[model samples]
Target: MSATFTEVLPARKSSKHSAIQWRPVTDDTHVAGVLTIHTDRASVAYTVSEFPTDWPGRGFLLAKETAGTDPESERYSVFCAAAGPWGDTCDCKGFTYKATCKHVDAVRALVGNAWL
Candidate 1:
């Protein structure tokens, strides 16, 4: 599936002759379900939310770029898992896990056009 951008802005030039670059600080795997990015004048903090049935929530500050343009622009995109696992638990009595599973993956592919 194509990536979606929530915000877009023009790039800013730092020095009159120097070029600015827009770099992505997060990867698809890191921000699969991230809901927000908090930023200070110098840096940004990524806020990731977990499925209620999974592990604890997670957050991180981006230290480098993963992808994007040069001469940093204000435009930004958010990536979402197009598909995920779901359905009744498996019959295996010894297994116990929550959150989207392989079943959800199949459903997501049929519905969202891609898997997360």
Candidate 2:
């Protein structure tokens, strides 16, 4: 008789950015959703707090650039991936439109591309 033994349990999946020390935004700011996730996180408040965690364990400040007049205008909203509906998101217009932006890229580069 031929019999096949199935594994007792499936392998455990780990987050790539688990090393990142993410925090909650704790603000009323709203971010458009790009990714739809249903999985539950250990901390609902920190569900989006996944990414680079090697930063100096301190408070982070996001600077939102407002549009300028006169001749040139540079307007951009700094993305805060620390907290979001789906997590790993930015607040930039590009990210809102394409779900990706230079700010996000820069963070990925700074953190060695460890985003979930």
Candidate 3:
């Protein structure tokens, strides 16, 4: 099935917000997070990292699945880079400190590179 992603922001911002919820739809579904996906019968919504909305109930997001031998499994390797239509992100200290990281560089090289 094809999936489309979307981003949503709160009507307003506030603190003390600590809930997430999922309500069933007749023929539609949406997942809200740091990114989102939409489908005929199921959809996912991702929040903006810059200014996140308050989750209405409780939920957990599984962004990736990796083997124990993978670098993702290393404590110091908490981040891997991503790039493309939805945008780009990396979670390493370099990314956090400098807003750039080798992981992103590697991804760009592997993909033949592009300017944003």
Q: Which has the greatest lDDT?
A: 2
Error in Å for residue 4 of model 2: 57
- The positional error of residue 80 in candidate 2, measured at the CA in angstroms, is 7.9
Candidate with best TM-score = 2
In order of listing, the candidates' clash counts read 14, 4, 19
Location of the lowest summed lDDT over 10 successive residues in candidate 2: 31-40
* Ranking of candidates on TM-score, top first: 2, 3, 1
> How would you encode candidate 1's per-residue C-alpha lDDT over 1-116 as one tens digit per residue?
33432322222232122211222325554544322221122322223322223322211222223322222533222222323232323211111343322222222322243212
Best-to-worst lDDT order: 2, 3, 1
User: Judged by lDDT relative to the true structure, which candidate is superior, 1 or 3?
Assistant: 3
* Per-residue alpha-carbon lDDT of candidate 2 for residues 1-116, written as tens digits (9 for 90 to 100): 22211111111242122222223234534321111111122211112322234433212223322221211413333334444322445554546776654444433432332322
lDDT of 3 by residue, 1-116 (tens): 34332222222122122121222222433322232222222233322112122432112222322222224422222222233412434555555775553333323332332211
Model 3, residue 100: distance off in Å is 0.6
**TM-score for all models, in order of appearance:** 0.18, 0.28, 0.26
Pitting candidate 1 against candidate 2, the one with the higher TM-score is 2
Regions more than 4 Å wrong, model 2: 1-87, 113-116
The superposed Cα distance between candidate 2 and the true structure at residue 6, in angstroms, equals 49
Q: Is candidate 2 or candidate 3 better by TM-score?
A: 2
**RMSD to the hidden true structure, all candidates:** 16.7, 18.4, 16.3
